[model samples]
Target: MGAMAAAYGPLLPYLMRRFAIGVSVAGLVFGVHFAGGLLGVTASMLSLGRLTSRVAVSGALGLMAIGCIGVALALSWLVMLAGVFLIGIGFGALDLRINQMLAYSVNPKRVALLNGLNGVFGIGAVAAPILVSIAGARYGLIYAGGAAVAAVALLGFRGVPGRLRGASSSGTAPSSRRTARLVVIFATAFGLYVGVEIGVAGWMPTHLHSAGFGLAAAATLTSGFWLALAAGRFLVAPLTLRVSDSAIVLGGTAVAVLCLAGALIAPFAPVAYIATGLAIAPVFPTGVAWLATLNPANPGATSWLFPASMVGGALIPSAIGLVIARVGAGWVPTILAAVAIGTLAAFAAAARS
Candidate 1:
């Protein structure tokens, strides 16, 4: 999932060259891909009772492999989009099911495990840009490799059980009105966070290139950004033992805002963006654990978060693209800083709710 998603960072230039498209058209890649993600999450939610994890996870992997092949062989821009949408579907469904299963598990170490899981995602994300750089115009090779990886991952799921038992909790369900409020607030927060994350990952390379950095250096810096994110997740797992999840999230977001602000300087851009990754690493998983703690009765509390994230992933990056079209890519970090502020506000609202 990380490799497939992060490939867009370095792949954007090749895509524009191949399709003879501008930033605006290139922006649709993230939109169409994440639109499919929303559908996948919705489908998985709807199929909870009907489909088993073994079936759902396996089917998703199958779709991912098929989608990657579709992308690799696409002859036209539209066909490539169709392929990306398919990949999004598989990515969304797989992401939701895994997170849902972990959220409902009885394991006491689930929060740390969630961080570890996403850390692995960071690993793949860290590798993708380097691979894309090496592949160059043969960008299709990256997608083909993603397909191969998905195919191999299928074998590992054979032992996964069909049904997951929801962990037992003693908290009473909140009033409907309060519950709805919490949902809206957290949804907004998740949406904003995801938007910021994807927006940075998708646009930072281009931003750096526009700022006069070489493409290869930009790609390496992008990988470094993901490396920081991956490392932060592993480093923060132990902190969960002593720090409150809410505090961790608040502190992380605050620091991320500062890092993004610092990124506005050309000389500090790479370092600042990489620092931003570390700052925001704990927000998503820790937010999940925090939400679960707040609303224990609903094992599906985190379900809303998945679709919200997909919405963020879809809308924010495209929105950034639009901004780039109008102003220029150098403003990328400024735009992201503004989005991070919105994210901070949303999380604050969630805290009150």
Candidate 2:
């Protein structure tokens, strides 16, 4: 899922060339993809009451496999969009279900485990560009490969159980109020954090290219950002033995804000962006774990977070694009810094209350 999701950006130029389309038409890929993701998340949330984990997870994987096949066979750009939309649905549902399952699990090592799981996603994300480079104009092979993996992964879910131990629970009014507040704060925090993460990733290459770096160099630095994220997710799991999840999120976001601030300097921009990814790597998984702990009575507490993240992924970067059009690409780091600051503030508020 992560590989296919991340593949889109690196694969965009090929997509455009393959269909003989301009940037204006090609850009709709993101919108179509994310729109499918939002609907997928909603569908997953709605299915909480009716669907088993095995059924939901399996079905999502099936959709992803079919979507990839669709993209692999598509001859037109619109068909490719449709394929990506299908992939987004599967991606969104599988993402939510897996995290939800892990967060609500009873394992003592679950925090580290969750971080590790998300780190694997980072690994997939980091691998995507390389895969794109290898596949070149035949990028459909990458999607076809992803489809094979997704299909094979279905066998792993046979023992996931129809329901989890803590999958469902009831809450009282006071706890409900607290849960609602935490949800809003964390959801907002996640939205902003995802926005910043995706924003930096989506714009940094362009920003660096505009600043005079060669296209290849800019792309390499962008890959560094993803590598840092993957590395951080793996490395931070050890810290969970000594530190609390909330503290980790707070510290990570704070450092990310500082890193983005440093990125405003042209020479330091690449290092700063990479550092920002490293700092924020553990925030998403750690925050989800922390929220589950806080609202143990409601297993569905983390469901809303998925939608918030999707919205942020779509909205924040688009907002940054508007500012970039008016001003320039140089403001990319500045805008990301502002978003990181907002993320830090949101996490801080959540931590306090």
Candidate 3:
């Protein structure tokens, strides 16, 4: 999340200023980023049979670090676009491999908790804007903020374990066709959910600012969305133990729709902005937990779902960006609301399956 949010958050505003682009173009940038991830996912799946899990993960992280540096240093919009694509590819590979590790490495009872811990990305998402806003305020766009994030990611790469490397050499025997179909279903649901969540979170600060809030105020609102998302994921483990996963998912989706609707239609900025966070809280971790339950044998299923969702995360915002350019920024939330409805549909399908 830090890598993604760090690369994109300031990068969004920077791209807009540099290219004289609109929100749609900004969304397209994200789309291209996810397109990179799609490529990464395809690559990882194909290579899983050939490479050890550790090598795949390490390679992915290495690519991400390189991509981060590229984003930080790029001189032109086209270069930045290419850099973001590399970032996507790296993130997708790391995401898939790490998830594969988690699914295979731990006990079934702990999978949900492990998944919730992944919600730390939301924490990073909450921080990305503040970091960019503060840095951009002082050092100018190109020199300070994103560069610092890249440096940190490079340093952090050292902490990744050696055991996770080359673990996939164990190889795959034939699995049930039903299992593959289930993975596809879950992946599609995840794709839609991610698209809506990231699209809204990615674009919300700008949307709120345009709606008449100050940058500080808008950042606070964006933080609320991520904080709530993180908090929701932390809560999901206990909640799942009590209620059915389907009930929680369906109820969360219902609340999300209402929150998004309130954000879209409400006349008052404070009410609408707060509604955005309140509505989005349950999505990421809850979605992962749902998938984990469906296939206890493979934790990678959750990882696969995450990237698939990220594909949506990349695409939906681009779609919203297109809408913003043509229709107006006010229409972005309406687009978000529609995506929320689609997420609800995805959840329903998941529940049925």
Best by lDDT: 1
lDDT of 1 by residue, 282-345 (tens): 8998888788777765755667788899999999999999988999998899999999999999
Which candidate leads in TM-score? 1
Residue 280 of candidate 2: its Cα lDDT? 95
Give per-residue CA lDDT, model 2, range 1-353, as digits (tens): 66775666556567768999754455566656667788888788777657888999999999999999999999987788889889989988888888988888888778899899998898887777677766779988888998999989999989877765555423212247778888889999999998888788777766887788765566667777888888898899999989999889999999999999898899999899899989999999999999988876466778888888878877777666667767888998989999999999999999899
lDDT of 2 at 60: 93
| Distance from true location, Cα of 240 in model 1, Å | 0.6
Q: What is the clash tally of candidate 3?
A: 12
The TM-scores of all predictions, comma-separated, are: 0.96, 0.92, 0.84
Model 3, 178-240: lDDT tens digits are 657667776776777777677667777767777887766666666666666666667665665
- Candidate-wise lDDT, in order: 0.87, 0.82, 0.65
**What's the lDDT for candidate 2?**
0.82
Name the weakest run of 10 consecutive residues (lDDT summed) in model 2: 166-175
On the 0 to 100 scale, the lDDT of residue 77 in model 1 is 97
